[model samples]
Target: MTRSLHDRHRAVLPDWLALYYREPIEITHGEGRHVWDASGKKYLDFFGGILTTMTAHALPEVTKAVAEQAGRIIHSSTLYLDRPMVELAERIAQLSGIPDARVFFTTSGTEANDTALLLATAHRRSSQILAMRNSYHGRSFSAVGITGNRSWSPTGLSPLQTLYVHGGVRTRGPYAHLSDARFIEACVADLEDLLGHTRDVAALIAEPIQGVGGFTSPPDGLYAAFREVLNRHGILWITDEVQTGWGRTGDHFWGWQAHADSGPPDILTFAKGIGNGMSIGGVVARADVMNCLDSNSISTFGGSPVTMAAGLANLGHLLEHDLQGNARRVGGLLIERLRAIGAQLPIVREVRGRGLMAGIELVRPGTDEADPQAAAAVLEAAREGGLLIGKGGGHDTSVLRVAPPLSLTVAEAEEGAAILERALRAV
Candidate 1:
């Protein structure tokens, strides 16, 4: 059965589209923190479908909202009034720290970020963008232009002229030797130096935690320091919160809040979790920046009543249950446990990230070279043990990514860790 399906998928899907595992299993259904494949094999889903499942599989609130909305109306383009869209926007506006915020919904994070690029360029009157090294925004032409990860970027041709800066990855880079204070200062100085060479820089877009770049994060106050510099040039600060939003980070509702000393970002983008399994993404900005374009535009599917209903229900459930607190408590334990696990294994060079998002970077024992082979071995081993994980890094893809639902239980976490430990030991 798997062989026939694999052959069909290869014939239909693009070659570049990635699939996990040497023997990829088709997920048929999921409930709570577990999912079953076509072979009726169950696995603890730590990656949460690339962190899109913010709450849980088949969450009652989101399922009910989606069903009811579908029963009434599945879609109504932006030409008409949408009560669910308006209500969700109002809630997001209040939660978004931007003053006089405005929300524009899109179907995916890629579109949301593409909209952000349009707004930033139009408002600042420039096409140059400042982005961090080893960062990923999206796959659109505009987004790929700003992404610093060469592995994910398909081509150099892009709409915006982007300058790569340092400081996203704390352990890897030129200033890796510096202490936390000096590292922040070095990155700020690098930004200032780069700014001196360029004119009318539109914005500096960064992920509070570099999601596809192996869940690495900068020092807590690094962005606030850059904000102090960007403010002087009237350049915008756009935070890509697609993978880092909705209290998944444990300590904050949004990852950028870790650097909230200078206040909120000029523009913010989010997706991949707000609607649970439903597709929902959006850009939030102050009125002046969002209203810069003169031409009228509307997404055919963006902010459709159905998706908005899911978003509203999902957000309500997240906030009401205080899943952020659970993430902080449970995730802290998971990280501590992983660190201890890593310490005993020579393959694990480092264990990084906060909250429920964690990464274990593998390296050749007694060396600095990345060990992608070892990562692949562990991935297959873990799967055989009934655990599903993920992998990402700069170029070698050596970092193992583990991001479970915010509602993940301590017992499930322990079960996943035990499986991971055995896998690592085997590798």
Candidate 2:
């Protein structure tokens, strides 16, 4: 049955839509931190469906709220007053650090980011943009234009003139060997040097942790330093918190706080975990930037009643239970265990990340060359060992992404780590 489905999917879906594993399995349902494949196999979910299923599978609060809202209205466009949408927007605006913030909802991270670009370009009256190296925002035309990874970028054409910047990947770039202060200085100097060569720029956008770039990040406060230079040029700062928001990063709720010295970003975009799989995405910015457009704007399905209910409930559950605290506690244990395991494995190049969001980079034994083959082998092995992890990297998908539900428990973390250890050993 899985074989037939795979064949059917290949025939119909675009080839660019990547699927996991050599023999793909259809996940029929899930609960808590685990899920069941079509073959009735149970596997511990570590990647949380690319960090979208944040709180858990079938979180009762989100489920109840979604169901209740569906009974009333799933969507009514943006033409009428929607209580749930307004309520969620109010909550998010208050949480967002931007002064006098205004929120605009979209259907996905791509849309949120695309909207941000429109605002930045219109407000600054410039189409030039700065993006970080090895960053993956989304897959829309505008999002891909700023994406720095060639593997994910399908075209060189773009409406915005995007200049790739340094400091997104701490280890792969030219400043890898530098200390934290020196690395920040090098990146800032590079940014300043580049700005001297460019025309008017709209914004400097980045992911706090480069998600598809293998959970890679620069030293803390790297962005704060760059912010100083961008401010000099009157460039807007946009933080794409799609994967790093809602306390997944352990020490901070929003990933941008790692550079808090620069104050709040001019614009912030988020998706994934916010809805716990309900397709919630939006941008929050100071009123001036968010209101830059003069014409009418409305999202056909954005801020739908059902999705808003889900976001409100999911955000509520995440905070009421203090899942951020749980991520710090359990994720710390998990990272320690994985680092200890990686120490014994030659193919493991690095174990890096924060809180529940961790990455195990694989390389050829005794070499710096990325070992995508070994990563794939370990992914398959982990699946056989009853674990579901994810693989991603700029170097041909060579990083193992381990991000479970924020509610992950200590015992579960240990269990997943043990299974992952055996998987690596098998590879």
Cα lDDT tens digits, model 1, 1-427, are: 4558888999999999999988778999999999999999999999988899989999999999999999999988999999999999999999999999999999999999999999999999899999989999988999999999999999999989999999999998789999999999999999999998989999999999999999999999999999999999999999999999999999999999999997999999999989887899999999999999989888899999999999999999999999999999999999999999999999999999899999999999999899999999999999999999999898888999999999999999999999999999999
CA shift of 236, model 1, Å: 0.2
TM-scores for all candidates: the values are 0.99, 0.99
| lDDT (CA) per prediction | 0.94, 0.94
TM-score (C-alpha) between model 2 and the true structure: 0.99
- Model 1 accuracy (lDDT, Cα): 0.94
Ten-residue stretch with the least lDDT total in model 2: 1-10
Clashes of 1: 0
Off by over 4 Å in 1: 1-3
- lDDT tens digits by residue: candidate 2, 1-427: 3558889999999998898999999999999999999999999999999999999999999999999999988879999999999999999998888899999999999999999999999999999999998899889999999999888999999999999899998887678999989999999999988998986899999999999999999999999999988898899999999999999998999999999999999999999999999998999999999999999988899999999999999999999999999988899999999999999999998999999999999999999999999999999999999999998899489999999999999999999999999999999
Worst 10 residues of 1 by lDDT: 1-10
**Between which residue pairs do clashes occur in model 2?**
none
